[model samples]
Target: MTCGRPMFPGSTTEDQLHLIFKVIGTPTDDTWPGIIYSEEFRGYNFPHYRPDPLINHAPRLDAEGLSLLAEFLQVGPTAQHFLMVAISEAVFESFGAAVQRLSDLSSLFEVSGISLHKNPGLRSSATLTGRSRQGR
Candidate 1:
């Protein structure tokens, strides 16, 4: 959403660490589950911080778009959506007429039981050679 440089940047590892503390703050069980159990987590040494709201990062987005963006930006592994389903949902949510046209097109092929996946390669070489002879 930000499309900006890293919130935490530094010349050295420790400097970056300090920047992370300043920007993202310390990760807790609630903010980042299982972070405390990670091998790299050091206890009580770094300063704590709370992140700014998502709205602050994407000031230009409208309320409806922001809500959808929030759903896609959710944390944790299980929060993820299937790529195709997410795209379809976004398209339908954002463009009603286009979604309807796509649905109509899909119904045209549904009766044939043939899928686009069945043809996976380029046009046959015979087709290419035939085209070359047509101009002769």
Candidate 2:
């Protein structure tokens, strides 16, 4: 857990979804299959939001924690699981090496037809880590 508070603190389902979207951005057709078929969602037009940096919401986390959190927060279950395995194997690597491994994994996922935008948090995490380790 990055912060000691709930990530999405909305009491109602709709409100909670809005909160989630505020952080992770709205799901597109590529991200959510059959979403168009939902009558409830079909009538509602959700605002398009760019995914925010996890550090913006969870400033308590360090680069390593943010990197791990980013991997676990991928859109689809399969992507999340895949990254989980990769992250587990990366545990033995140094912080810089692990971040590089995650970047490589992101490239691999994209090459394998997974949308790169599906994991903006990872990109943001990597960027932040790079900035923190400037000149290293």
Candidate 3:
């Protein structure tokens, strides 16, 4: 996607996180609600970083693409699911339909006893299964 240019090409986990923070900004409790609960992150004081606009990092992306990329880069399952619904609606119907589609999908998932937040792997499995069934 980056044309072989790795975005945050750091050699170690900490270094990678720092690079990500430099661009995406440091995660806050609001942005990353459960980060403080992680054993690896607990008590570690990460330096504050203000978000650098994506254009500063990926100059090739246009405004619309950057907007979509920002949504795709969101931190949690709920955000990611919303991004997926938004993208699907944008592609298959009108963007105005996204809210309704999201509601519909949420209700469908609830009825099916599928929780994307609890088992993210099911999303991958379902996607793969759908692709296979489509003979794609």
Candidate 4:
């Protein structure tokens, strides 16, 4: 759901992956800061209708986090070449279906350096790419 997701050009959802999270002390119902957004495309149709569940503060990596993540991916610990591009993104449900299938999710997470660690079960799930984890 996170990787391989692309948006239609000019789609209102495009480049919106790094959404602004609500401030920790802010009220849930409080109005947005009224920042100027590139005008919404009311007439536009995302013919491929999708739902949006934009979560705040999407998990990401800093230089340090990336080093940690890289070690987990086993592609190497100094693998800074990838995290800068993958770390920061909102990944709303809008992009899920188009990019989903058992294989893509596993592959994406592998690239993201998020294999199950510490969980005894993960030893197997680590090798179960292209398959959902639930069934195991």
The alpha-carbon deviation from the true structure for residue 112 of candidate 1, after best TM-score superposition, in angstroms, is 26
Q: Put down candidate 2 lDDT per residue, 1-136, tens digits, no spaces.
A: 2353567899987888788888887777777676656788766677887789989987867898777666666664366566647645554232344343456435423322222222254433322222223345
| Cα lDDT tens digits for candidate 3, 7-55 | 7789988888888888888887878888757778755567998989998
Cα error, candidate 3, residue 7 (Å): 0.8
| lDDT agreement of model 2 with the native | 0.60
lDDT tens per residue, model 1, 1-136: 1222343458877677666555445667776688767766663356666655556655555787566655654444444444335546642333333333445235422422212221224332111111223344
**lDDT (0 to 1) per candidate:** 0.47, 0.60, 0.59, 0.30
Clashes of each: 1, 0, 0, 1
Model 3 weakest 10-residue run by lDDT: 124-133
Q: Which ten residues in a row have the lowest lDDT in candidate 4?
A: 18-27
TM-score of each: 0.39, 0.53, 0.57, 0.18
Decide which is better by TM-score, 1 or 4.
1
Which structure among the candidates has the greatest TM-score? 3
Record all residue pairs in model 2 with backbone atoms less than 3 Å apart, i.e. clashing: none
Give the total clashing residue pairs for model 4: 1
